[model samples]
Target: MTTPVLFIHGLCLHASSWDPWIQLFRDAGYDPHAPGWPGDGATVEASRQHPDAIGDHGIDDVVEHFAGVIDRLPSPPILIGHSFGGMIAQKLLGQDRALAAIAIDAAQIKGVLPVPLSALRATLPVFRNPANLHRAVSLTAEQFRFAFANTVSEQESDELHERWTIPAPGKPLFEAATANFDPHSPAKVATDNQTRGPLLLIASGKDHTVPESVTRATLKQYRHSEAVTDLVTFPDRAHSLTIDSGWREVADTCLTWLKQQSL
Candidate 1:
């Protein structure tokens, strides 16, 4: 049987972020399912009107939401996620939920331990507003430049800032910031489990959010599964590699990985 694919979007964005990848996967002969977070809207525009959405969504909430989508599917679906979605994917893997996975510029993997200035700056505005705890704060143009468009052109950066950047839950960022505080952080990505199946971690060398060192450190956490834990870095990419210019390359890489592991 063909293994279905679960394409989970990152924090703030909805399932619509998978539109391009979804169509690409279809051509590759795999089923793709993308799910929205609990308070997410059906469309990006609709989501904007409700600025309070995603503010309180925690890692557990995102995990359960993705698991719910996987449960309704025929069987365990190959999970692919980005950013916060990537953290949720690792959480799902700990439960032994799926057979294979691919994470693109995923944030906060088990061994990843770096907080770049850019990431901190992009997140500062969220923490600045205490009300952001109960309401999502859409990314401003400057914030987008720091977090998602660091590697793109000025025009492209502005376009991305307008099109895709939206209010996101501050809870995930807050939790990620605190991961180093407690030894038993619930938000820590679980990569030590060897039975988690084939997995790939794709990092954007240019990504300020998930730095190369962070993703590399994450590999050590899965040292036992050296063969299954694959890592790739897009030298010219940023945090928004999936949507950045030349995204087709990233999409193609993901499709190829899925084919090798699933098909």
Candidate 2:
């Protein structure tokens, strides 16, 4: 039987962002589903039109939303996530939920030190306004280009922005930034858990949002884990590695890894 796959999207993107990824995995014989964050609309148009629906939602809500989806599946699915979605994949794995997981240019979590300058710049729109913490935030095309598509051409970056970018909740950003200071913060992950399934962390060398350094530090935290944990770097890619024209390369790499795990 084909294994089930779940594609989790990042901040400022709707589930539709994974449409191509869903098709790729389906062609590879996997049953795939891309569920949006709580209150995120059912479609990109809906999400864009009703940004308020996703406002004020935090990371814990997102983790539980995906967890519920996993619970209802016939079997544990392969969890694949990007950016903030990658953080969700890690949280689920910490709970020993997925059969295997992939985190691509994942956002930083607690214990990750020395926040990257680019990452901070990328998140400035949200943190700049204190009131944004309780509201939905949208990014300008230029901001999106800088954070996600710097490695791609201007026209392609604009195309990516029109197709995938959308308003996202700002609460999660505040939560992640303050997680280390809060003992009960939901952004904390149990990296030492022995049962966390085989995990792969993919880093994009040119990514401005979640750089290689953050990914390496995240991997370091898992060094004590008994589970199989690996890291791979795509030197020419940016944060848009999973959505840009060269997404197939990232997908193929993941498919190869999944097959190696015999999932």
Top model number, lDDT: 2
lDDT of each: 0.77, 0.92
lDDT of 2 at 233: 98
**Model 2 Cα displacement at 90 (Å)?**
0.6
Candidate 2, pairs of clashing residues: none
Candidate 2 residue lDDT tens string, 89-188: 9999889899989999998889888698999999999999999988999999999999999999999999989988889999999998998899998889
lDDT by residue (tens digit), candidate 1, 49-110: 77666568877788887888888999888888898887777778767898787877777753
TM-score of model 2 (CA atoms): 0.98
User: How many pairs in model 1 have backbone atoms within 3 A of each other, for residues 3 or more apart or on separate chains, i.e. clashes?
Assistant: 2
Model 1 stretches with alpha carbons more than 4 Å out: 225-227
Model 1: per-residue Cα lDDT at residue 105: 76
TM-score of 1: 0.93
How accurate locally is residue 21 in candidate 1, as Cα lDDT from 0 to 100?
A: 84
